[model samples]
Target: MRLLIIAPEQIPVPPPVGGSVENCIYQIAKQIKGNHEVTIVSLYRKHLPRTTRVGRATIIRVDGGSKSNYLRNAIKQVKGNRYDLIQIDNRPSFIRAMKQAFPNTPISVFMHSMTFVSKPVTTPSKAALDLGRANLIIGNSQSLKRTLGSKFPAQKHKVKYVHLGVDLKKFHPSGKSGAKPFHILFAGRLIPRKGIPVLLKAVQIARRSVPSIRLSIAGGTGKPAYKAYLRQTAKSLGIPVTFTGGLSRRQMPVFYRTGSCFVCPSQKHEAFGLVNVEAMASGLPVIASKIGGIPEVVQHGRNGYLVGAYHRPEAFASQIVKLAKQPELTKRLARQARIDAVQRFSWTQTASKLTRIYEGHLNRRQG
Candidate 1:
C-alpha cells in the first residue's frame, strides 16, 4: 500500500523540538514504512533538504510562508503521485482541497486535538462539513472520540480513536531511583488550560511534608507574559521551581531522568496524554487528573495515582506527597509504569493498529 501523509504546513517533519502532531506523523510513517510504501509531505525547514530518504520512506518538504501557500506547494509536489491512502494531520481546511485533488483516493483526517474542530479555528458547521467528507475520522483517544461525538453526533459513527505512542527504547529508564531531593516534573505547552499555576500551588503544599520537593517544567513558554506570570506565581507561592524552557526531542530523556515523579494537573480534559506516556516509558510514575483519557493511562495504584478533584491543588499535592513519603511505593509504581508503556503503548504497535484502520478503509472502497 502506498500512503501519503500530509503534515500541517506549520512544523517540519521530524522537527527538532516538541511537535507532537508532526512527530506522531513521522513516527507512524517510520514504523509502517517496512510494510507499506510511505511518503511524508511537510513544510520546508532551512536545515532539512527538500527531499530526503529516511530508511525506506520518503520525506518531501515544500515552501511554507503561509498555510495556503504550503498547502498549494504540497499539492503541487504530490500532484500526480498514486497513493492508496492520503492522511491529513490536524487541518480540517485541507480536506476539501485534498479531496478535490485526489477525487478517487480515500482521504482520512487525523485529529491530534480538538483545536481545529471547534470555534476560533473553525465554525461548527464548517468543521462538520469538512469532517463529514472524510472516509474516516480518527482521534487519539476514546475520551476525545466521545467528546467529539457529543458535539457532532451526525459524524460520530465515522469517528474512531487510536492512542498515540512512545519510543520505548529512547525513553527507557536509566535504572536509577532516588528520593533525597524529590523532583516533580510537568511537560507540556505552558497554556492556562494546562493548569501550571495549580501545579505550583500543589508543590507548595507538598513541600510541607516533602521539604526536598521541587518543580521542573520542561516546555517552551510561547508568550513572555505567561512566562513572567508563571515565574512570579512560583516565587510568590514559595515553591522552588525551574522553567527548563523548551527541550528538543533528544533532550527529553535527560529531562525525564531528573524527575522523581511526573504530574499532569490539567484543568481541562485531555485527549490522550502523550507526555504522560513518555514519562511512564522513562520509568517515572505519573500522578494526573482523573478526567478525560488520563485515567485510561495512569491507572490509580498501578502505574500512578489519579486525582479526582483535579482542579484543586490540594488533591494533586496529596498524591505528590503520597509518592514522596513512600519511596518504595514510588519505585514499584515507576517499574510498573515502564511495564505498562512497553506492553501497551509503543510506536510499533501504534503503527500496526493505524495500518489496520487504513486497510479497513481500503478494503471497503474495493468492495
Candidate 2:
C-alpha cells in the first residue's frame, strides 16, 4: 500500500528540527515504510531540499507561508499521484479539502492534542463537518480520544487511540553514578498549562528537606517575557534552576540520563505526556500528575510517584523529598521505569499497533 502523510504547515519532517508532532510522524512513517510506500508532505525548512528520500519514505517540502498556500501547494505536489491512505497530522481543517482532492482514498486525521479540535482553530459545527469526512480520527492518548469523542458525539464512532512511542535505543540509561546535585528534569513547551511554576514551588519546598536539589528546565521558543517571569519566580523561591533552552533530539537523552528524576506537574489535562515515556525509557523515574493519560505512563508507586493535586506544590514536594532522601528507592523506581518502558511502551509495539489499525480500517472499508 502507498501511504501519503500530510504534516501541519508549522513544522518540517525528519532531518529538520520539529516538535512532538513532527517527531511522531517521522518515526511512524519510518516504522511502516518497509511494508508500505510512505510519502511525507511537510513545510519548507532551511538547508533542506524540496524533495528528498529518507530511508524508504519520500519527503516533499512545500512553501508554508500561509495555510492557504500550504494546502494549495501540497495538493498541487501530489496532483498526479495515487495513494491507498493519506494521514493528516494535527490539522483538522485540512481533512475536508484532502478528502475532496482524493475522493476515493481513505483519510486518517491523527490528533496529538485538543488544540486543533477546539477554539479559534475551528468551531464545533465546522469541526464536526471536517472530522465527519475522516475515516479514522486517532488520538495520541486515551484521555485525548475520550475528549474528542465527548466534543463531537456524532464523530465519536470514528475516534480511536494510539499512544505515542519513544525510541528505546536513542533514549536509555546514562548512569549518573555520583552526580552532585539531584536534578529534577522538566522537558516541554514553556506554556502556562505545563505548570513550570508548580514545579519551581515544589522544588523550593523540597529543598528544606534536601539541600542538594536543583532543576533542569528543557524546552524553549515561546515569548521570552514569560521565560523571564519563570526565572524571576525561581529566584524569588530561592531555587537553583537551569534553563537548557530547547535541547535537540540527540541532546535530550544526555540530559535525561544525567538527571536524577523527571517531573511533569501539568496544571491542565495533557492528552499524552510523551516526555514521561521518554524519561522512563531513559531509565529515569517519573514523578508526574495523576491527571490525563499520564497515569497510563507513570505507574503510581510502581515506576514513579503520581501527585494527585498537581497544582499544589506540597503534593509534588513530598514526592521530591522522598526520592531525594532515599537514593536506593529512587534507583529501584528508575529500574522499574526502564523495565515498564521496555516491556510496555516501545516504537516497535506502537508501530505494529498502528499498522494493524490502518490495515483493519482500510481492509474493512474495502471488503
Error of 1 at 289 (Å): 1.1
lDDT of each: 0.90, 0.89
Q: Write the per-residue lDDT of candidate 2 for residues 1-367, one digit (tens) a residue.
A: 7889999888788634337898898887777735688899998988789998877789999999999899999999996798999999999899888978999999999999888877787888888888988999999888988999998998899888988888999999986576467889999999899999999999999999999899999998569999999999999999899998888888888889878999999988889999999999998999999998898898898999999988899999999999999888999999999999999888767777887888899889889
Candidate 1 similarity to native, TM-score: 0.98
lDDT of 1 by residue, 218-310 (tens): 998678899899999998898899999999999998899888999999888888989999999999999998878898799999999998998
lDDT of 1: 0.90
Tell me model 2's lDDT, rounded to 2 decimals. Answer: 0.89
Which residue pairs in candidate 2 have backbone atoms (N, alpha carbon, C) closer than 3 angstroms, thus clashing? Answer: none
Clash count (model 1, backbone only): 0
